[model samples]
Target chain A: MLDLPTRHLHGPGPSPVPPSVLEALGQPCIGHMDPAFMRVMNEVREMLQQVFGTENEMTLACSGTGSAGAEMLMDNLVEPGDACLIGVNGVFGGRLTDKARRAGGVVTNLHADWGQSFSRTLIKEKVAELKPKIVCFVHAETSTGTLQPFEGLADAVHEHGGLLVMDCVTSLAGRPVELDAWGVDAAYSGTQKCLSCPPGLSPVSLSERAMEKVRSRKTKPNSWYLDLNLVGNYWSGSRAYHHTAPVNMNFALHEALRLVLEEGLEVRYARHRRVHERLKAGLETRGFRYASDPEWTLPMLNLVSIPDRVDDEAAVRKRLLLDHHLEIGGGLGALAGKCWRIGLMGHGATDEAVDRILAGLDAVL
Target chain B: MLDLPTRHLHGPGPSPVPPSVLEALGQPCIGHMDPAFMRVMNEVREMLQQVFGTENEMTLACSGTGSAGAEMLMDNLVEPGDACLIGVNGVFGGRLTDKARRAGGVVTNLHADWGQSFSRTLIKEKVAELKPKIVCFVHAETSTGTLQPFEGLADAVHEHGGLLVMDCVTSLAGRPVELDAWGVDAAYSGTQKCLSCPPGLSPVSLSERAMEKVRSRKTKPNSWYLDLNLVGNYWSGSRAYHHTAPVNMNFALHEALRLVLEEGLEVRYARHRRVHERLKAGLETRGFRYASDPEWTLPMLNLVSIPDRVDDEAAVRKRLLLDHHLEIGGGLGALAGKCWRIGLMGHGATDEAVDRILAGLDAVL
Candidate 1:
């Protein structure tokens, strides 16, 4: 049998999951259409709606990772010849743009510097000019550890009679993701990050407004696997069979969501913020500063500069893995090699975890 | 916490998983970029190639269910305006046709009755007329329990200068699927079926000929999540990050593949046939007849007519589940009220399991 080494997962994702979630995941899988399995799906859908801050009946976890959720929304909502305007500031935002185009949407990108957040005023101007049918933004940029605020962004898009879509892969449970409060139409999140689940399922939700867009699509969804119109029925509605869901993964997500609700969202967010602050203070004293703007930095994913004193960053990370069994993320895209993203998410968002990374960095560098 | 009842999974796809594979799935997750986890992925890829009977270097598991594998092949291979011919016999083949059309291909479907296999001459005629870039077939139709054979089908498509794609979801390990010998260019399978693993991952492989088509595509693949060119680099080449992989799920697949190899493919195939023969003999004695042609009935998935004495088939199935905890599939698509799909696949293909189902039906009826 193949063997795997256990490590403290403190990367951008997947953060460390608790033992109970893993236990639930290991349970024997029931049939997809079985009443017992359908009950599990219903429970997961209900809990995910709570975590995502939406009461939309279409809330459910997709079978693939977080990225599949984004694809589901884009392919189902963006019809051929529809104009899509997306705010691009990181890798995920760029990916959403690609999905929109593949769905045959006429795409226009609203660009921002890496590790920076977009302003609502600028988006309003762009929305007025493009009059796009759909507008997209990344609520939390995993590649840059930047948290975008939806202060007036949704209203701006709504003013133009367009739906608001979001990539909430990094912000769902670790931070505040009030989809209803923000008037967001559609959003998707990762199970590994804040839910403290294994990374296989993507919890996604769409407002009635977003479902309306999908219902009125001019063309069928481009990808059948991620087609919400069909998949949604399997999760709820008439309880049809769209595909064989990753049964065990849903088991894990159900447990993970239960854990989040048990701990409560506000408490989870506070815990993340506290640990991130601890890591921030320790890094600042070690001649490291955040790669993202202070105002836009995310609590769950901390992007910090690699000091010049550390000549070989990869070697340092390798040593940390070998010596401490610790895992931290290297910078991605524009910030690669210049910074490191240290995650304090879900079950990993504790003083012990944050201190371990700091101590490992001290011993290695 | 959400609770799930353990059922004897004998469905068409999610057959039955062993305890050992579930244990591997519950192991602590490591980072995606961690060398240890990468070794697990490498092992899975290697074993998948052996199971697929090919030297395709692009063999890897997608992070979704069985359908995701089909979507990966169709979305990556079928570009806009490309002529494609697909054989439609049951639900899965019709699904492949749906996928090809969504990928912007000018798809021509050669229709076959449910539970019927397509003839090589019929496909050859269609290929000669369309001169398609790709031809598709479902090796095992789960919906109808028909086992499609590649006698001269591959040659017909190849002679017409096209790639042959197959859905081997229900046949990969339980039945013979000689991708290389059959001249198959691409194929995909499910972990839930013959692999005896939980449903969530789809094992897929593409020959160099198929990869060449993907590399030379005019437009980007619709799905960023299933994009082979990008995801392949993450799995092998640079080991760069694509998305957060389902870490523990890879561990489970590695263990599942290990079991397949240890059991030996020939012995496993013989075991499946033996148990299926047992069920067939018992069912024939009990006034139940196979819904498929005797020559083409799948050994792993037995579609049998619901006895006329059982006026309410759903009630019988519910009684079987509630009383014996045995889960069997009701007929789908065109055969909804007419038959039951009795799956004896992978770990579920055993004398004891087969007898248990027969006893349950005998008692319940």
Candidate 2:
């Protein structure tokens, strides 16, 4: 065994996978099309729908990570020359823009500051003007740890004849994501983030309206591996042979989703919020300020500015990891060097995990 | 935990994972950017280079199944309108054709019978005629269990100033895949096959020449997620942040690759051959005819026609799974219902597994 380091995963994601889920992951490998494994797939689908708060029949896990789900949604719904209005605030939204353009969509990006959420009124205006085939937003901007509220934006996009596609990669299961009630046409998330599963399978749900758009596409999706129609058939009734589904990964996700439902969504969200509040108070006492806007800060992914007393942020982080065995994310892109992202997500969202990070920070500082 | 019915996996892929690797997978989930995990990634790269028998520094695991590797290569290397002459024999070859088309390649399919290898002269003639930019072939077609000799074909493609790309998904560790010796510009495989890990990660290697072609692409590859340049940067020295990699899956692969190297490649290949021979003798005694071409049949995956006596093949397979807890693959596409595909891959390619399958088949018969 390659030196199994005991890391307190306080990073963006994989946020400390639970023991039961890990046990589930280690289950014997079986055929993807096996009847028994198929039952696990069916259960996983059912659980994913519950977590996503969607009644859509097209809910299933894609074979890759969160970005694969992002690519899948864009590749399937946004055909060549189809107009897409994307909210660009952080890394994930920028990634959406890139994915949409790659899928041959005529993309119009509405920019927001990295640490701030998109202005709902601005998106409404853009959607009304462009009347795009799809309106894309990142519900939780992981890079900047900002949560964009989609209260009125969904209705505005749908009214303008656009499908509402949201990237809930960092928010699903840990936050409120009412897909059916909020009128989300499509949404996708990674298992690692809030689900606390290893980062492989992507839990995705699509509304009937989104499926209709995908089915009516003028051409096949850009990547055959991520084509929703092919993957969906394998997940749903037809069970057609697409690529061999990741069997053990599915097993892991099945148990992770089970744990999520077992804990209950409302309780899970409250736990995240509780830990976030504790961490926020702890950081404030230690002279750290929230990097993301206070009004839109994500409960799970807390972005904080490096304190003035810390001369070398990298050195401090390195020492914390080396001495304390705590792993927190250094910022990405614009936030690099200026901030550190501390995640209290899924199984990591506990007073114990918060205490560990806070104690590690105190020691390092 | 979900009921994980113990199965003796003899499917085309997702061969039974060993206990140690599963334990490694169950190890504590860490941050993808953690230094310890980075070390694992580095070791995986080094071991993959050895297994592939290639000096290509670009070797790394893509974050998906075998088919994701297919799409990545097609999307990155096969530019829009570039002539690609693809060999079509089984489901994998057909998949390659679809992926290449989606990547905007001007595809010219050279068809061979499903259970037969492509004619060297025909491929040579086609290459000379089309002088395509990329010459694609499946090194081992899993659907038909036929091994197409890539020897001499690489020189032919290179002579026409083209690159050779091979799909070695089911052939990698169990078979002799001398990527550098054969002068293959690019190749991809799955962990579930001969590696006998799980089915999420795709181990891919690209020659510098192939990377150059990818670098010179006019448009970004059709996928932002599977973009080789970005993923490669993460694996190589820069270690740029890409997607949150499947952390525990990488751990599983790291241990699996260690196991592969410990056994040594030649010993592993011989073991697969030894079990294949034993299975072949038992199968022949039971009056099962090899469906794949005898001269080129893959030792790892044996595709054999069900005997005349077996009227309900599906019932026999179901009983084998339900009663004896042994699982083998049914034929796909053209060979469906006509044949049964039995795999002796990776950790599952053992005398014990072979004996178990044989006994189960006899009991069911």
Candidate 3:
């Protein structure tokens, strides 16, 4: 086996997985249809409901990464020629637009600056004008660390006769995501971001409203592997086989969800907030500035502008990884070479990790 | 964490993950774009080339299970109204037809009885008559334990100006699959079967002809996550960011491929055959008959007809799991409750494993 170096993952995702979850992942493999594994799957579903703050029965993990969740939602929810309006604030929203268009939706792209969130007024206006069947946006945009406010957007979409789909890839476990309270019709997340698990499975939940659209679709979902109705049947009590579940990955996710519940959502969210403040203060003292607005910034992913004196962003990142054994994400797409993304997610959102990253940046910069 | 029982996995797929691959999985999580991780990816691609006996540049692992690879290939290769012919002898072939139809292909499914392989003459006739854009079939049908021969089918498809896609999910690491020699345009496999890794990613390879088709597509693939063009960019020298890869799962796959190369493909294939023969002989002595034809039965998965005395198939499988701590698959689809699928794949194809399973079956029966 190849010898792998230990890394303190402060990157945009795959944030350091905890040892307990790793142990769970390394457990002996089991059959996907095994009774014991089915029990584990049920527990995972229940825990995901708790974490998502919803009573939706169709809460389960897709067998791929977070991007699979995005494709699954778009492919199943958006039918041919269905008018869909999307908030294109960051890379993820842009991705949604691409997926929606490919799924044959008449897509209306609403643009926002790289580091900004979509205003509710703009979304409401678009919903009224476009009369879209689905209104989609990201809850916590990973590309730009923006925490979009989603309080009345669902109501706006519903009033305009549209379902609401939210990409909560980076927000699910680390923040308050009240799906029912926010009236979200559908949402998706990843395990690696705030769940302190490896990136394999995507946890997705869809409300009755979203399932109704899927049930009444004129054509089947374009991707059979990601057909939520078929996948849901397997994940539901019927347990009909769709495809072989990633057994060990499910084990890891179950443990990760357990850890999240053990810490409690409120405590975990407060911890993330507290660590972000400390890191913000430390970075400011070192002459670094955040790229996103303070009110819309995500506590888990801190997007910061690259200092003017740092001539080589890649060099600084390399030095940090090589010398300090740390990993932080560089900018992507429009922000490439212009900013840095320092993630404080799940296990990585700790005081020690923040101190190490701060010290590493201080030494490298 | 839940205390999971140690199981001897003899299922149709997810045969058994070796200790080394499991150890690799438990290693510290790293960034997907980390230089070290990139090196691992490169090595995995090279090793897959050796295993598939092809130098296709597009060979890489998909971010989901084996079925996801099927979706990816069909979604990318088949555009709307594209003529596609699929051989449906077993569950996997039927699955391909479903995925192709969902991808908007004009599908012509050629049917065969369960536990049988498609004849090359029939495929050639179908290709010539249908004038399909793509011809698809499964090489090793896991559900039926039939190894379909590929002696002249590729030539037939190529002669008719059609791209040939093969599903090698259960054949790649355990059997001889000459993609270049057989002229297969595209093929895909799962890690868990003979690669001795968990089921989280699918290893896919596309010939130049396949990539050319993908490049010249008029419309984008429906499922963005499974689009090979964008995913290939991330796997290629460009190393563009597509999505967050399953970092640790890739690590496990890399280690598993290393083990396959170390054993060498010829030797591994011979071992699978030898163990399978021994298990078959033992089962025959106990009055169990094989479901598949003797000429086309796969070495990895042995589908056996339950004896008349054995009234309850589920009861025997449950007893094997509960009493013997062994796991085997029951029949699926048309063969449901009529047979059992005992696998001898990768790490689970050892003499000790075969002996233990036989003894366990004897006790349970």
Candidate 4:
């Protein structure tokens, strides 16, 4: 067997998986419907609801990556010419709009500058004009490390008789996501991000309103695997087998959820916040400026402006990988080469890991 | 963390993973581009090529389950109104046709009875009439445990100026695929089946001509993550990041591939065949009949006719699960409750497992 390298993952998602989670993942494989595994699966659902802070019955992990969740939500919520409003401030928001359009939805964008949160007034104006069936936005934009203020946006969407679908891919475990309290009809996140599991599955939840819309959808979902109705039934207590659950990955996710619960959601969130503050302070002392303002910054993934003299962002990333065994992310899309993404997520948010990254950066600089 | 129950997995695809592969899967998480992990990834690519018996450059594993590979192949190969021909004899074949149609392909089926293989003459005749851009078939029909002949079909597809896409999901490591020798252009298989890896990734390989067609596609693939051109770059030497790979799962696959290579391919195939013979003999003693003709039966997955007196297949399956700690598959689609699918695959294809299953069946009967 080819051997694995020991390296601390400091990238956007898939932070260092704890040993307990790894042991859970390596457990004996079980049938998707085995009573024992099903018990764990059901527990995972309840635990995820606790993390998402919602009581959505349709909540469960999709068998693919985070993007698959985005596509699944779009496929179920929108059909041909169904008006949808998307927040487009960073790479993930652009993806949401693209997926919405691909699903035959008429998409209108509430544009914001990269690393800048959308103004509540602008969001209100867009909602009033488009009055779309769904108002989609990212709670924490990983690409620019900006967290959009969703309280006003959610209220605006609801007032206009629209549902709010939020992308909490980077924020769910690191920060509070009040799905019920904030009126989010649908939300999706990755296990690898703040959840600190490997990156193969996406945890998604839908509110009662969202489930009702799916129940009353005009078309059969375009994709079979992502069809939430069938998937929901399979994941529910009925335990009807649909597709083969990624058994090992699910085991890892179950452990991840267990870890989050044991640590206490509030404690874990505070841990992430503490690590973010330490890392940010260290980076600033070393002459770095964050792309997002302090108020809207994501605690897990930090976006920093690249110095002009850097010249080759890829080379610097390569150096970090080779010399320090540190894997930081590069800016994506329009922000490429101009910003770097340093993540402090899940297990990687520990103080030692933060110090290691800072020490590596000091040596490199 | 929920402890995994020790159970024997003799189901359709997510067969029991070997202990070595499981151990490898639990190894610490690493960056996808870590030099050590990259070496493993490269080795995995090489091993897949060896098992596939082709030097195709685009051989790599998709992050989702096997069905994702099936969907991705169709999404990349077919466009709106493109004429495509599919063989429909069992559940998986029907699914292939359904997915193709959903992807906007004008699908024509070469019909065959369930639990039976089609004649080469009939298939060639049907393909000539259809004049399709792509001709799809399943090497092993999991639902019916039928092994269809593909050598003649591949030649016929080439003669008609069409590429052949084959689902080797159940056949790859269990039987000889011979991609180049058989003239098949594209093939996809699940890791859980014959490789003894947990079900999370599907290894797919595309011939040069098939990839060229994908590269020159008229429209963007509906699913962004499944797009071959984009996903290939992630696996290619350039190492452009696309998505966070399920790192631990990839480790499991690498070790599984090593096990396959260490136990020679021919020996592994012989072992599967031997265990299948033992099971067939035991089942015959219990008054069971083969669902398909012996000549066309797949050794990896066997379909047995349900007895007339024994009704409620669900009860029997449930009893098996509860009493024996064993899991076998039931027939899907039209054959539900009519047949039982007994899989001898990966780690499940052992003499001990077969003996235990037979002992349990004696009580059920």
Candidate 5:
């Protein structure tokens, strides 16, 4: 039997889930097709729509982690020979490109520097040239802790006759995610990030036009388990049965959404911003710098450049874990070892958690 | 708020978890990389190995549902232009074929009737002809409750110089899965089925040969999250922390595996078989016939033909929930509404549960 250690999760996602959500997770398992469980599923779907700010009827949680949702959406939306315009500014953006290519879509990438937002000018030019069926970008890139503003990108895509898909994995609960208001045709988010829930399910919603494409697909969905057309039938539309869902995780997510709604979306966004502001002040006081531009940083995830003298990032991380029971993330891909990503998501973004991380870094530095 | 109706789950999966496992789920969330939590992860990995009957160093739980594991293995193992062979006996087998093809593999499938086992001779011939990179099959088809015996299929695969991957999602805990002894190169299982854990993580293991292929891949895996080379870092050597694991779900699984091991693997296997036998007797007494062959049926999941008079499978299912508060699974894909899948699995396979289901069914019938 494994016992959970007492530690403050200051790393990205798998944040400190509220005790209420944990209690919800322990509730007894139910059949996915059970009327009562389906009822909960319906409420979860509605709540997810509220959070995502979408009226898309095809909204439901994919039975996997965040990236699986990405793959599921891509698998159905993009097919062989279809051109896809991908905005690659971080690891997750790179993933969308990879998934599209694997699905036989011809991927055209609009590259951006890691920890940087997409340039609308460059995207508009690419859209004009490639004219892809779907224009995909990450709203909040978890790897680089950068938020890409797409306030007008969707309109650009629509003008070019392409639908917009966004990755809201890190932004869904922490900030305002107006899927419909922002004209996002398709989007996916993880439960573990700002939701203050354990990582497992990925909530996805698709616009009516996107739903039509899925319904009238040129080919059968390759992955039957995640074939959203059929999955949606189970989730909605008469509550048809599919595979067994992660019942307890759904329970946890439902409770997490309840908390998010209870706090109100605005309050949740404010909480994230407040903690990030305090943490930023403390880090600046400690002479640390950030990787992402101040204007584009995610409130819940802060990726900062490590000081030159911090030769061994792993050692520093180990020290933090041993001395302060604080867990932080090291940079990935090209940024590996150069930056530390400190997260203040959901229950983790508190004054005490922020102070402890700063103090731990101070001791190590 | 959607209230969960109190129900007895005898469905194919999302099987009713033990109260202990349920209690474990509600425990406070911990950081995935927390040292104590890593120890818990280590226990889960080791116990998974014990259950899998493998010494594969790469054994770890992927933080997704069973289908995600299937997608992960397919993405990592198969690439563009790679040839693969699959035996299609039920929905799962067909889904695996779809997954393989979606990952850009040129798939050749040998079809078997639903609720029927494969002929090793035919598969061996196909193996000789196709010479595929991967030969895949389902050990236990949950939809039809048919157990396909490997027999000499593995040796044939190795003889043809192909790696054999088995979907043990419905077989692992309920049956004797001797992975190393049987020469299976890679395999995946779900926590929700025979393990009696909630569905969030998929336990997967790979042989040394499979790991070598993963290490030597020419292209980056299509799905970044499911990529074994990267994910293995989080689960094994690199411990690089690829993604935030579903912390509490892992705790629930660790405890579930402990319960599995504490009872002794053979004892647990026998317990599942014993409960299945009792349930089968009860179902037989009620004049219900199993869809699968008697010799090839999986004990954990029983696929029974619903009576023709029961025109409304959905209504019966609804009535079961509303009137009796018991849950069972309807058929999927080709088997939809034609049959019902009843599960007798870990903790949920008690004799009392069997009696309750029988009584409930009698009242409904």
Candidate 6:
């Protein structure tokens, strides 16, 4: 038997899952097609709709991680030779560009500084120039801890007769995501960050408009596992057999979603904001500066530069994990080694968790 | 709170998850990139190799169900315009053809009856004729409870310079699967079937020959999520971050694999065979004939014909679930309502479970 030491998950993801969700995950396995499991799946779909603020019947969980949801949408929507424009602000945005290209879409990249959100004016200009069939961007750029404002972007794309796709991996449950109200066509999210579930399933929602594009595509999506028409049939009332649903992970997501609804989305958002402020203040007192702009900073992931005196970034992070039993993320890609990501996500966004991470950082420094 | 009643889990999947695996699943989720989690991943990879009977370095769990593994292999191996041949004998075999087509493969389907296994001579003849880039078949067809033999098939495919891909979802741990000795280029299995873990992750393995094809592909695999190169980097010694792995599901799979290795594969297979024979004998006394051929039937999933005297199949199944707390599968696709699937897989392949399911069926009849 292997000994697994428990650590406080304050990293970018696999954030501290609640006991209820873990308990649900450990519940006895059931057949995927079992009526009992189907009922649970129904509840999961309903709760996901409430959380995503979408009335779309296409909302469901992709079996893999958040990346799977991104692939699912891109594969279905961006057909061969279809022009797709993406805002490459950070790692996730860059990933979307890669996926779009792989799906055989003619991709056009719109660039923004690593920590900066894309301006609506810039997006509108791109939409006007490229005449893209789909405009993609990250709602919350996990790599840079920047939350891109989605206001007017959807409408701009819609005006151009294009769909707006957003990656909400870091934003979905931690903040307000008005999918219907914002007129967003397609969006995807991970369960770990804001939902406080272990990472596995991706909650994806496609508006009827997006589904229409999928239905009218000239060629089949290159990925069989992610073909929405087939996957949607399984999740929809048809209950057609596709792949076996990851039953236990779905159980965990169901419980996590139940907790989100129980807490109320507003209260949960406020809690994340409150804890993030506390952590930010503490980090600032320790001579830390945020990498992202204050206005665009994500509440769930706090990206802060290491203090000048802290020369060994890896050692500091190692000490936090080894000595204090706490985990925080080092920056990824171009931001690597320059900054640390302190997550205040879902269950980890409590006052006690914030205090512990702050004290651990102080001790390590 | 929703109450999830415990069932006997005699369905095709998810067969009863063991207590140890469930306990491991309930353990606190840590960061996906955490050192401790990485160690567990290493152990899982090693154990998976032992179970798969392969020295293939490219073995890891896809962060989805059995079908995700299927999709991963097809997406990576069958590039656009690549010729792929699939043996469509059962539901899973038909799915292989579908997935291959979706992956942009020029598909050639060889059909067999629902419960019949594919003949090696037919596969060799097809391989000689089509000279496909990839040849796929199911090792165990869960839908019809047929176990296809792999003798000479891999050599025949390899002789024509085509890769052999096997769907070992129901066979891996329940029966002998000599991946290296048999020269199988790629294979994937579900955790819930023979491993007795809850359905979440799919264990996948690829031979060096299969990976060479992936590396030499002209186009990037359409799915960024299922792309093996990126996922392999994360699982391999490089440990490059691809996607946030389902940490707790990996934990469950790790523990489940440990249990399998600890029991010894041969002992486990013998146990399954013993329990299956006991149940088959009991069913025979009730005039319940098997749908699959006697020699080629799967020990893990027994597809038995429903007696004509028992007209209310759904009611009988419902009564078993409600009154006896047993869960057996109804036939899928063409065999729907004509046969019942009684699974004796992994933990459920015990004397006690077999006796209980048989007694319950007797009561229902």
Q: Which candidate model has the greater lDDT, 1 or 4? A: 1
**Residue range with the least summed lDDT across 10 consecutive positions in model 3 chain B:** B151-160
Each model's Cα RMSD: 1.2, 1.1, 1.3, 1.7, 2.8, 1.4
In candidate 3, clashing pairs total 0
Model 6 TM-score, 2 decimals: 0.98
Interface RMSD of each: 1.1, 0.8, 0.9, 1.3, 2.3, 1.1
* Ordered list by lDDT, greatest first: 3, 2, 6, 1, 4, 5
TM-scores of the candidates in the order shown: 0.98, 0.99, 0.98, 0.97, 0.92, 0.98
What tens-digit string does per-residue lDDT give for candidate 5 at B103-211?
Answer: 7799998898999998778888899999989999999998899998775777878886679999999998888998888899999999988898988889999999988
Candidate 4 C-alpha lDDT tens digits along A160-257: 77899999999988999989888899999998888989888999999888888888878776676787877888998467777788998898999999
In angstroms, the error of model 3 at B146 is: 0.7
Per-model chain B TM-scores are 0.98, 0.98, 0.99, 0.97, 0.97, 0.99
For candidate 5, write residues A200-246 as lDDT tens digits.
88999999988888888888665666788778888888666656688
* Model 2 Cα shift for residue A68 (angstroms): 0.6
- Tens digits of per-residue lDDT, candidate 2, A47-79, equal 999999988999999998999999999999998
Residues A1-365, candidate 6: write the lDDT tens digits.
56899899888998998999999999888878778888998999999999999999999999889998998999999988989999898898889989899888899998988889888888888898888999998999898999988877777788878999989999989999999988899999999999999999999999999999899888888777788989899898799888888988888999999999999999999999999999989888878899998889999999998777988999999999999999999999989998898888998899999899989987877
lDDT of each: 0.89, 0.91, 0.91, 0.87, 0.85, 0.90
How far out, in Å, is residue A280 in model 2? 1.2
Which stretches in model 2 have alpha-carbon errors above 4 Å?
Answer: none
lDDT of 3: 0.91
- lDDT by residue (tens digit), candidate 3, A1-365: 78788889998988998899999998889889888989999999999999998999999999999999998899899999999989888899989999999888999899989889877888888888888998998999998999888898887789877899999999998899999999999999999999989999999999999999898998887888988879999999588999988999999999999999999999999999999999999999999999997889999999999989989999999999988899999998899999999999999999998899988987887
Worst 10 residues of 5 chain A by lDDT: A1-10
- Candidate 6 chain A least-lDDT 10 residues: A151-160
